[model samples]
Target chain A: MEGTNFQRYLARKKAMSAYTWNEVKKHKMLYLFLFPFLLIFATFTLAPVGISLGLSFTYFNVLEPPRWIGFTNYLNLFLSDDIFIIALRNTIILATITGPVGFMAAFLFAWFINELPRFIRAFVTLVFYAPTIAGSAYLVWLLIFSGDSMGHLNAYLMRAGIINSPILWLTNPDYMMYVIIIVVLWMSLGAGFLAFIAGLSTIDEALYEAGLVDGVRNRWQELWFITLPNMQGMLLFGAVMAITSSFAVGEVTQNLAGFPSTDYEVHTIVNHLVDYGAMRFEMGYASAIATILFISMIYAKRIVSSFIGKIGR
Target chain B: MIGAAKKDKTSASGRRIVKVSRAVRKPNRSLGGDIFIWGILIIFGIFFIFPLVFNINQAFKPLNEIFIFPPNLFVINPTTDNISDLFIIMSRSWVTFTRYIFNTVFITFVGTAGHLFVASLGAFAVSKYDFPGSKFFFGIIITALMFNQYVTAIPNFLILTQLGWIDTYWAVIIPAFGMPLGFFLMKQFMDTIPVSLVEAAKIDGASEWLIYWRIVLPLVKPALLTVMVFAVQALWNNPQSLVIHTEQLKTLPLAISQIIGSPHAPQVARAGVNAAGLMVLMMVPIIIFVTAQSNILKTMASSGIKE
Candidate 1:
């Protein structure tokens, strides 16, 4: 009986390989089509992650060959690097606030605009999307949050008698994170937001009608029963977009608050990574930083996906 | 609420009458809810639009008006002098302004085109076919979407150095081809296309390449435009300063920033020119988005993660 069972398992494995080989042979042209992208992707996008993970355990500063370090970077990151702790904490706060807020705002605005007529919806979308596509237009935020009395926010506050002196909105450590949050949220209505608008529009109108017939007496009830469940795919997508962008909030801080921002108050993991990688050429340490961020993001995404999977259930 | 429920029930029962009346199916939206939503939208609209308006207005402001106390949102004495000054500054740079434009336009065009072509081809194959490892390949792409460029910057630099692509157009354009967003979005959009359409093409004895290029590509125009817009936006804004070290190799955004001077530049004198340069820098992506947005919306309609 044991011999027969082993033979059966071997037979099944052989059959699976044969089937896979046949599929590969039949769709050989499709592989050709996919080759260029996969090659580039493997080199640039995929390999980097693996390489970064590997390099995280080494010590290299680009000029010298990498030396095996054996978790020294990770140990330093957690136990000794006070700045890394601040960055990690700041990243968590930024992601926690902006991720959910951006996600909800994307959904809510999409739902709101879904009720509008055709052309108006398109125009409103442009209005919402302007902040993102207007490349470097985010520099406008520096003007608004400029650290001087002549700055827009400062001028307004001073006029309103809300403050005795101008608040150095960008430079002030106390106000920096809030200013960054406001700017990020302002620009947060991005691709995910567009996806939500599209998702809302694509949700079958008949489902709402059917839902109404089934005693879904109000818009809110209809939404919970029909709309949310229908667009769970988009909710998941939007959430991922929101979470990833929220985690990668270095550019806003770098540009607005200035790099190595005001005693590293607005420093994030990405900034820390950039600080080491670009400025300092500490490739191995930066790779370690990148690995932490990559793992944390993947972990965050998994949690979000499980939660989104249960939405409207 | 009771009256509406009664009406709805009657309408459901008298289906023919309901069909005519519900031709314009405005769902049961309360006046208060409508007001509240509109109010919120308007407030958010201001929040979204005010900064952009202020920025654009600054481009038009005369030098003195730019430095006015409280910084007026509207420019009273608008001038094209700043725009002219921006051109003069660009011309006086060590590299010709057209050289920078050529570099940018070349990079943007090649990068966007290559990305769209390669990504869509890959997307089509993955979406329509189920060859061995197709699912695994697609899984990687999805996972790639969960992170951004920051995480990969270090390894990417090393890899580029190995490839001898640094300090060349390929450095900027090549990596863009691997940006997972376009491929993911293309696959999502392509999934909505009927499999039967491809089967029909196959029955007509059309080659796979022919089917992808001629039949399916045309059908997914919205996705193509959507991807193009995104690619263009990214490449256009990409400061080529990262890998391309040569002054002549720098892109438009870098050139524009130079003319705009630093954020620390004396704001009173440079404000008008700075604003003008920024406006010029921003216009390309803005214009591209505005033109392609309707198509983007259409493409995005189907761009959802499959459970």
Candidate 2:
């Protein structure tokens, strides 16, 4: 009986190996086409992700060998790092402020465009979207808040007698966060606006007429019953896009606010990560912060998706 | 046909009556809303376009004129001296501006082509083929879409370092070749293509590659163009990525950043140069978009996909 079982196991193993070889032979061309893509994807996308996950457990500098420090980095980040705490608070603040406001703006713009004549809509959309293709949209904000009396906004305000003195828009600790938020809202308006406009276009006009017949008396009722329901998936997708963008607010924060905010008011988690990980070479600690960020985003995404799913159904 | 024409005439007159009633409700008060709408839109438009206008205005002014009180709103007397000076600086600088443009064009073109090819192939496979793990792969791609570039920054840097691909075109082009977002767009677009065509092509002795290259590609040209526009914008504006590459192999965006950092950079001239750089960067995409606006919008509408 033992000899028979051993022979059966050997036969099964041989069959499994043969099956694998057959897969390779049958899909050889497919494999060949996919090879280069897989290599690059693994190298750039998958490998980096794996390494970051691993590094979240180790203490390393680019200059020295990584030490397996386990979860000490995470423990220290949670308990000890005051800056990390500030970054988390500030990033949440910025995201909360921008996400809803930006979404509403995009929605309103899209709705308005949908109501306009075709040529007018096309021209206006182009005008609104043109700034995105140009790299200096943020630079435009920089000029407006140039920190000097000569700054365009300050100049206009002073000329109009709104204030006797120029406000230090970029330098003030209290107002700097607002300034960054405004710039982000302005720059991000284009993409979200485009998405909303696309969503609005997908909504069937018959649904609105049907709502009217069903006693949807006003614009609000029509929107709630017809437009919103019809465009639920797009709306959810837009929300996800907005959330991702709000969390990943790096370039504007870095460019406008610099390293730390004037009073540690506007420094986001991403900025902190760059400071510690890239500049200071604290790989383990930065990884911990990043991992926390990742987990929070995942959690937030779950909440958002659930809310959207409820509305959609 | 007579009944349809009669119904259309009645509806047209009904619309006119509705407009007249709306106008009569409160002429001044109703005008207020119209004014308010235009007012807000105009303010926002100015807000958006003012910087580019300001930059262009500043570029034509002399260095001393840049810091004038009230900030010169427009150029009264423009000169070619700034342009001449810009050329002289470009000629003297070790960094070749022309080469930088070439590098940018090459990277954008190759990366766009690579993305179009691979993304279309991958999209076609997922959209058309029924295979084990296809759904799983699709889910993985969606999850990967949520992974921001910043999250992958350090690890990608390390990987690039390991592969000794730093400062090479491969570092930029290869990594960008398989964008999951582009793949998603393509798949969504291709799904709209009828399945009958694929079977017909197969019956006619066309291989999958031939079908993809011939039928599928031509049918999805508008999507491909839209994706191409997105790819160009991303590559063109990508200074942060290029900074990780070698200094000498810098693209135009990185070059602008470098010029910004230089000590001898003139304030007024810098604005102009940035304006010029922006104008140059935007020109191609804008022209492509404008010329293909109807086609792109129609395609986007049909596919029901958003970036």
Candidate 3:
């Protein structure tokens, strides 16, 4: 009986290989079409990621040969690094706030815009999308929050007697996180938003007509019965984008508040990684931070997907 | 079975002309609702619109007007001095200003085109085919989509150096081709295309490549253009100082940053020059976006809440 079972297993394995070979033979043209992308993806993307993962456990600082030290970097990062803790805490706060807010805002605004005439809809889309496409335009936010009395917000507020003096908006740790969150949301005009707009447009109008016939009387009911269910895929796409972007809030914070903010209050996990990776030349530790971030994000996406699945059920 | 779904799909979900007419006819249908929606839009518009307005105003202001106690919102008199001064300041650089434009345009065009074609093909394979590793490749891209793009920069830099791509255009454009967002997006959009459409093509002896190129590509043009807009936006704004090292290879952002942030410029260090540079950095991309705005906006129709 054991010999027969072993033989059966071997035969199954052989069948699988033969089937796979046949698949390759049949899809040769498709494989040829896919070849260039897979080559670049493997060489540039996959290989580097794999190498970075390996380097995470080492002590290489670019000059020296890598010395494997197991999980020392990870241990230090979690157990002892105070700045890392602050960054981690701030990142979670940012992700929780901006992720949901941006995701919902994208869908809601796109849905609203879809109600307009085509020409006006296009104009409105460009207007809303201006913030994202306008690179470094968020620097205007710095001018708004500038410490000088000449700053726009300060001047207006002072004229209205809203404050005694110009506040150190970018510097003061108390206002740093709030200001960063606001700027982030302002610039949250992203690919996902455009994708949502496009997604909303592509939604078949007949679905709404059928829903109206099916007793979907008001816009709200129409939205629920017709729109949301249809946009389920795009919703998932938006969520994935939102999660990645919200977690990657370091760029905006570093640019606005200045990297290594006063009291390090505005620091994020990506900033912490940058502080190690770019500034300190500790590639291993930086890779470790990246690995943790990558894993955490993947897990976050899983939770988001599972939670999204439960909605509208 | 596929034929039945195809017939039903055309009858039930084919473009609804009546629904569009009803929406257009109902313009004054809800005054209060319009006010609410427009109210929200106006507020968000202020947030989104301020940057473009501010840049234009700042560029035209004389030095005195810029630092005045109560800042003016719009320019009273627009001048060409800033533009002229920026060109003069830029003359001091090692490379010509046109070289910078050429480099930027080169990278943006090549990067955008490469990304659209390659990413869509990758997406097409995963969406339309089933092979041993198709599921795995799809899973890989999804997993890739989960992480921040900036995470592997150091490793990428090291690999590029090893490939002798550190100072070349390939260093910039190659990695962009691997950006996973377009792949994810194209796949999502392709998933919306009726499988029966592809089957109809297949029944006519259409090869897989032909089916994808002709039948699938045209159907997903909006998504293609949307992805193109995204790729263009990224490559256009990409800083020269970040990727390439050569002075001649410096993209627009790097050149602008250098002049704007230059500590020891006599005339160019002024805020006017900075404003001029900002406008320059901004206008080209804005013009391109405005030109291609229709194509980009086409994605809006197909990308939204689907049935």
Candidate 4:
């Protein structure tokens, strides 16, 4: 039966060539609409991704020819580079702490704020979202944590006699991770937060009424019964975004804590990739780092999607 | 048969009891819950506003106030000298201040408008059409979303150089058409449009283009507006975009970062100047946020529910 089915599929394919051409002709308008995007994407995005993968297998520094040295790059990254290992560990830790925490905070804030009467809710949303929108928002945190007597946080701490001297907030490795994490969380209430608010509104009011009628006692119960089940799709989207951003979190560290952070305490995989790619001209090694980062994000997305798939089931 | 009949009867009876009781009750909206919600709202409000307020306040602070023994959170004596000097500082450079603004606006408008059409067209094709390999195309988009864009930056730059697009607006503007987020969001939103509407148009002899433009595009207006907001944000905030290398074409954010990052951007006025730049950098986005505020919220409400 299987052999016959395979034979039939092959026969259909051979017969369908002219017929498929007609179908393709019928859909020419869609193809036309799709052309510009595909053209640019093929040239820039798809081609570059392929290039990065190709480069990952070779030893290339722009001035020299790309020497094919497959798997050695990967092997070196795993075993020889202690810095990559530290970066991997730090990235995992940061993701675990902030990813889920920020996700929940975003949802909770959006949900509660949504319950407010109209105008005030908009005002509040703007307030919460402003920091993320402010392009140099992180610069403000840098100022607050500046290792100067005049820094606001330091001035307050000194005035209150909490410490003897102005602390090196960004420089000190002991406080670096915490400071970066806090600042990240503060700025994390961005598009995803707005997404949750929007997602909440899409849920029908009739569902809530029906849920209460079925003996739902309070807001929490209604949320568990009706809201979560209804917005599973949005939740999944938010979770994927949250996980991606969480893993891709070296920028704040690069900005706040110096890049080769004191003993590389705050280094992330992206920073390690940049260290090779940008600072050094080892394009092949950087590509290898990027490949690993790419693979990890895909893996993270898979795990997150599967987990979200189980929500409200 | 008897046992099955008895089970069905009991379950039906139970369902009736639920329905009858459900008919008696109304949805609760307690004042106490409202009060508690407001309390939490106020706390998060303060937490969110402090950094923004401080940054804005710095725009008006004197250099003395900026570096005082105990730095003032609120400006005691506000001044416009810094704002005037920000212009003076830019005038000293090869690119004038207004030129940066023009470059930024031009790039942002062209890039954003291009993305709006190109992305939506791609999205419309995927969501509404049953063309061969459509699934594969969309799958590639999903995969693209997972990967960090920076990983591709080097190779993309190399590609641009090969095409002789280096130091050109085409290098920047063309790639904006392919942003995965805009495509993803628009496609998801378009998916919700009813097939019957398209079918009805087709029955009335509407061309595919007409059906798309008149029937489908208008339905996803909220999504389009939201994408516009995002496109503006992405183009405006980036001081680090690699494409624009020519001094004549430097955007506002790049010039602003230069002003802030320079060691000798007039020392006494550096803080004030930096603050003024920060304000300018954030101003347009803030205005957009305020103006399209509802549309943004509406888009968010509809988004993130689909894979």
Q: Estimate each model's TM-score.
A: 0.95, 0.85, 0.89, 0.91
Error of 2 at B9 (Å): 25
Predicted candidate 3 versus true structure: per-residue lDDT over B202-284, tens digit per residue: 89999888988888998998778778877877777768455588999988787887777732232433777778877877776
Greater DockQ among 1 and 2 belongs to 1
Misplaced by over 4 Å in model 4 are A1-22, B1-35, B262-269, B305-307
Q: List clashing residue pairs in candidate 1.
A: none
lDDT score, residue A208, model 1?
A: 80
Q: Model 4: per-residue lDDT, tens digit, B1-307?
A: 2323443444455655444545543334434566677888898889888888888899898888877777888989999878888888888898777888888888888999999999998889989889877888988886776556667877987788888888877787888888887888898888888989988998999998898889999999988998999889888887645677788888888887788773222245487888888788887788888888888776666566455
lDDT of 1 by residue, A4-65 (tens): 99999999999999998998999999999999999999898889899999999999988889
Task: Provide the overall lDDT of each model, using Cα atoms, as 2-decimal numbers.
Answer: 0.86, 0.70, 0.78, 0.81
Candidate 2 interface RMSD after superposing interface residues: 6.1
TM-score of candidate 1 against the unseen true structure:
0.95
Q: What is the per-residue lDDT of model 3 for residues A134-170, given as tens digits with 9 covering 90 to 100? A: 7776666766787678878889899889998988898
What would the per-residue lDDT of candidate 2 be over residues A1-313, giving only the tens digit for each residue? 9999999999999998898677657656555455555566667776777788889899988888889999899888879988888888988998788877876776776665665556687777776766656654466567778677888889988999998999989779878988988878776664446656776777776777676557553444455567766665556556666777788887777777665667777889898888878889988778777777777777766776676666524
Winner of 2 and 4 under DockQ: 4
Question: What DockQ does model 2 achieve?
Answer: 0.28
